[model samples]
Target chain A: MEKKYVIGIDLGGTKISGALATVEGDIISQYTVPTKASEGELPVLGRIIETIEKVLEEGKAVVEEVKSIGIGSPGPLDTKTGVIITTPNLPFKNFKLVQPIVEKFGIPTYLDNDANAAAIGEYVFGAGKGTENMVFITVSTGIGGGAIINGKAFRGSTSNALEVGHMTLEQDGPICGCGNHGCAEALASGTAIGKRAKEAVTQGLKTSLANYENPGSYEVFQEAAKGDDVAKEILDKALTYLGICVGNVITSFDPEMVIIGGGVSQGGAVVFDKVKEVVKERCFETLAENCKIVPAGLGTDAGVKGAVALAILESK
Target chain B: MEKKYVIGIDLGGTKISGALATVEGDIISQYTVPTKASEGELPVLGRIIETIEKVLEEGKAVVEEVKSIGIGSPGPLDTKTGVIITTPNLPFKNFKLVQPIVEKFGIPTYLDNDANAAAIGEYVFGAGKGTENMVFITVSTGIGGGAIINGKAFRGSTSNALEVGHMTLEQDGPICGCGNHGCAEALASGTAIGKRAKEAVTQGLKTSLANYENPGSYEVFQEAAKGDDVAKEILDKALTYLGICVGNVITSFDPEMVIIGGGVSQGGAVVFDKVKEVVKERCFETLAENCKIVPAGLGTDAGVKGAVALAILESK
Candidate 1:
């Protein structure tokens, strides 16, 4: 029989989502379960195994029908070595993910950073298709990024390339989680957006955002859209930082396009339009003229589909 | 005769150098002429043509064997259009370099940024030979950079990808000529080094550098080597900035190696040792361990050799 199926696992902070998909990239079935962080590695592994089993059962496929498994997890993980070195969100440190998954499933396994996997998903099936070079940026609680060059993930010399979020935009702007000052993440991340809103409220600034019991970034954006002066100021500051970061990426990489994703990007045109304007104004004319900035197309399914792509590619 | 040769021209603000080289990269003959750029573009173009003719004459029989010509000059140039759009050092504005060379020599000509040509030269025949990914940084009057990825010059989405020197290391440390704040060039270029030395002298910091009638970076390095506290302090500051820039590049690109050139890099082990120390300190352990830093081996001949490489590759 022809080889037709692959397994894709997206290991998030709280759950593991696994899917079995056909070679054509159509998902056959999927399973999801709690990651149980406090239960440690063995329990997490058990959950992953259960998810894989459930997906296979739902697909009604024998073990021989599956090709390989791919896992997309938060990093500093070693893609070459298949080790999850130390991810703050995950319970295990230096977890040997590949060997365990391969042994348990009796098939090959591959691992990659979630952001990189998402970038590959974009490159192969989403917004970056047909482009030789692209940058994918996800602006959530913390910002993350990935690069695609020449149709493959550009994994820098050490699998740590495309850290666009860590690049400094304002040298003296704010303290970052990475212990740096004025990093792009420190200025424009979801955390930063909320922090700005909170500071404005505490500083006696008048705004509709103050009505939220605890104003998060989304609420601030909501308030700003509704014509709250303080919320508008905070949103503007976030956009300015976001724009500079976008300009910096455009200048440094010169990618054909940049795909913006993550929760904060859900602000939609409010963030996207302003970022496009700032990047156009600040980046070199040549770069600004050529680069197209677009929202990520895959949305919530990007991670799982990226993992599936990895499985198919790695297995072959 | 076996496929003839190519003319490689390197245009600088003060001089124009051209070489007649075999397809195998063996130089048959070379010549240089004063640009006298103060007199402006027409005269400079005249000097460039004269140098090309002089080299062809010296090569004699090899002239008949020449295939194409390539010119490497300072940018911002339109590589696709073969036009020098604007170069701070050159008098020309929007000079069409290719039309003139092709018109006069009756050979297809290629034009690229000097830094990019140097990078291609290094990639093909110099320090970066056999490597698919590398970054070449030249620290002269100002810092300039180029990138080679997958055995070709990585010219971003447009023809202007690697402007490493302009990347910010200190968000607000110093103002750069490019109208940016805290660019790597502003912190560690030869001009920056010279500025620090002059400032120290004006501030009445005691140092052996004070004895020099006209202090340059070379004298400053000499004084620092001799254990002048102020000189050492300034040199360390420069090294710190250079190291951060290097670390950032390493983190961002993941190239197998980074080659340093230009006059300031010629300060030898003093700058090299400091740069290595800082890169190790700032970069992730895996990246720091995997990447190598080395001095550029091509010396002043890099540009001409790189232009030859460009011609050979483009002709093919």
Candidate 2:
């Protein structure tokens, strides 16, 4: 069999990362560019195209050698038509993402929400490898996630399922960015943690967290790890809410494993241990018994790897 | 195509319903018998076999004419091994259900937790017909559910993913049968409604619901519709929980439609309207915009129909 290559791209609000990989998923070359998305779609698209061209150039591979291009973009996208419906971070709506790339390279292009790509990436090469069903959740600026079932990305009716982060954890609780009350993202995400810490300071309940102006989730975790009571209280509460979200996902999806990734999970044992404890206590015993809760193995590479997986699988 | 017939059985604590259906899902004959579960597994199994025999006899079909046998029993069962792990409402543990039925008739047999069967049933022939993905939720004695994705029952990694009823809705809320705190079942199930109403009456609340000796969810709904404030409050709260569950399911699964089943949904528009309202308000606009919230189409026959769906699909 002749060796085949594919181009994988991860499109984010701040940066675009592109890579050339073998059909077996080995990255031969990669390139990155700042998105500067506020400059508008054309410039961002130019950067994305430049990154892809640079990866190919660095790999010394011709376009003819590449099987296809796959992109994982911040989305609520239409993978079927390869149209980006809307992205919170990028200024694109109903953007014909695939057609433009396909036209440029005369190759098939596939598109999926970044979260879904991460899930497929993990399922194909990371923590959930060899599993028939799994959920990949990323707790970053805001919680986001995707599901892989029966060894494929489980896109629902509109090619978008696995919006795990938006699941309502508490009724009539805090309002979320998506306008829902008490969604998992609103209660347990990095943004939520930072907001809670800020609120504590605003309420005049001073602690070590107050030292960092406009403290983010990382600062809060740092203070908590040092045994700061106020910071510890906030972290514990946020982790507890995250635990409830994990429990709910387990009960609903019953995946073989759940892979936790993102900036928040970088807290390591502090996050996974607390969340796993809640899941063990809350999920159905049978499900809990079979579920392996683990951290994502691919890390930053999840985006490009996932895009590659999507390209390979969908192309087949 | 040659005409093919299959047998489907819905085994419950109180009754066992069996039906003979063509491969195309036309039910030709059906039978039912008392489970008398307290009489033990052997007696319950005997009743189940009797119902299957009666259905076959009524249809004038020979064992050779039946393609397979499918049973949907109260679950937490191993679909791969055809074993009933343990049912909260039934006295069956590690029972080799499929092997026994297969031996009795020398026909292939498939067994699924009842909720999964109902999901397939709805997907194949009822409310979710023609959809690629759907969720079937039975809000009955206790809330339970299943999913049909890409035209197949979505048995999670352990063949038990769609435990929608056990999802955590509120932190530190009521305990569920599954021993979880603030689960959807604990907050919205018929049993929960009755328990809440009984508690209200016990608390010396003045309401017409007090006229009933043991008011179940039905009596509470009736009184609430007739202007009982206490009953109205209880009903509204329960519906809110149900709506939240529905909303959460929508976001995570992104199914084309959600088919609401169970005894509680028998209240019809009164229940559906309120729940749909909540789902519309809670789900991400992209998801909620396309989701169709409707009542279960098969009504009481969901079990047998779902079992038939399981039989036909699995046999293929």
Candidate 3:
């Protein structure tokens, strides 16, 4: 019999979501459960496994029918060795996340960083579909990215290419989590925007944001849209940094498209317009003209769908 | 007879050099002729063909014995269409360079930007020989680069990737020849270094560099070596910017090696040391550790040899 199904697990800090899908990516069954990360490594691992089993049972599918399993998790992990080398949200520490699953299900498995999975997802089914080369940048609390090179996910020597968040934009700007100063993440990430806004609120800046006890990028975007001078100023500064980051990426990669995703991209035109304007001003006219910068197409179910896309891609 | 030979042409403003070589890249015969670009497009085209004929005759090889012809020239050209799209030094304007050669010789032909050809040369036979992923940066009058991704030259959508010279480092840096401000080329190219020294001399800065009639990077390096503080400071700033440019490349590509080539790199220890130090300071530790940053191994013949490598690699 032909293999007709695949399983995808999206391991997040709070929830473990699993999907049983056809080779075409239609989800037949899904299950979700708490990660209970505080319960430590094995328990969290057990929960991931339990969700997979639940999706299989609910879909009335056999492990033999599933072509492969793909798991998407936060990383700094080794994809080739399948070790979660200690991500912040997940409890796994140098844990062999794929071996036990392969043993239990007797199926081929693939593991990748969430950003890479998301890039593959976009390449296979989202806004980046049909692009020979593209970059997916997710700008939420942090800025992260992945590249689709020659129509495939490109993992560099250390399985860690497209670390755009760490690209230094300002030589003497804010410190980044990676111990570098002036990184794109340090200057333009959602966290950076929120921090700047909170500081302004605390400093008694004349803005409507002072209404919130504690404000972040969400409130700052809201206030900016409502005509707050301080809020507008903060978004302009942060978004310019974001634009420079995108411009630099375009200069370096010269990809067909740049797909912006994550919480910040949800701000829509305000975000896209500024990035396009800056890219036009900074990049070579040829590069700027040839490339399209747009928002990610994957919605709330992006994580799980990304994992499914990863399975289908890697399996092929 | 078995096809066991290739031809390489290094196209330049004043000279055209062609080589007939073994499939393995040993030069069997070579020829050089003045470009006489002032004679216009067809005359320059005829000169290139003449060089090819000269090399073939000198090598005592027939067309049937040659596998392919490769030409390396100044770019913004279309490798896909074999068109030389108006280069500064070359008289060709949207000229179809490869088709004529292929028609005359009845052999496959390839054309690539000089930088991309040089990168393939390094990947095949120079410092980047063993790297699966590497970036080649040549910091001469301008800074240009090429990337080898997964052991292949990766030209993005428009076949014009790795335009690193234009990457913005300073938001308000000195204007570049491209009319952009704060490009890596504007801040760190050998031309930029020379321009800075000229400005210093014109300003009557207290430095030995002022002793030269028209001071440039060579004089600056010389004076800096003699302990001229002004020259040393200029070098420090320029090399720092170069380092930041390289650091950002490492951060974005995560390649196994970064090969620095071209005229400025001949400064040796001063260039390498500062770039290495900055990369360590600015890039993620893991990326820095995994990537080897080194000067290019190819010497005077890199251009022609690169054309040879381009023929062999692309034909394969």
Docking class of 1: acceptable
**lDDT tens per residue, model 1, A1-316:** 4568888999989778999999767899998897887788788888888888999999988678888888999998889889888888877898887888788778788899998888877887789888988999999998888898766678776678877677656535688887766678888999999998888888878777778777889988888898898888888988878887777777778899999989988999999999998776556677888999998889677888889877876675
Ranking under TM-score, best-scoring first? 3, 2, 1
Q: What would the per-residue lDDT of candidate 1 be over residues B1-316, giving only the tens digit for each residue?
A: 5567888999888778899888878998999888788897787878878888888899884444678888899998888889898888877899987888778877888899998899888887888887888999889888888888767677776678777777756545678887777778889998998888888888888887788777878887888888989889888988878877787777678789999989998998988888888777655677778888998979768878888888886787
Candidate 1 Cα outliers beyond 4 Å, as residue runs: A1-7, A20-24, A36-70, A93-96, A99-110, A170-175, A195-216, A219-238, A311-316, B1-7, B20-26, B35-70, B91-110, B169-175, B193-238, B311-316
lDDT of 2 at B114: 86
RMSD of each: 4.3, 1.8, 1.2
Give the top-scoring candidate (DockQ): 2
lDDT of 2: 0.87
Stretches of model 3 off by over 4 angstroms after superposition: none
Model 2 / residue A173 / CA error / Å: 1.5
Residue B57, candidate 2: Cα error in Å is 3.3
Clashing pairs in 3: none
Looking at model 1, residue A197 earns an lDDT score of: 87
- Which 10-residue window of candidate 1 chain A scores lowest in summed lDDT? A164-173
Q: A1-316 in candidate 3: lDDT tens per residue? A: 5689988899888898999999999999999998888899888879888988999999999887999898999998898988889887766679898998888878888899999989988888899988889999999999999999987789898988899998888888888888888899988889999999999988988989899988899998999999999999999999999999999999999999999999999999999999999999999888999999999999988999999999998898
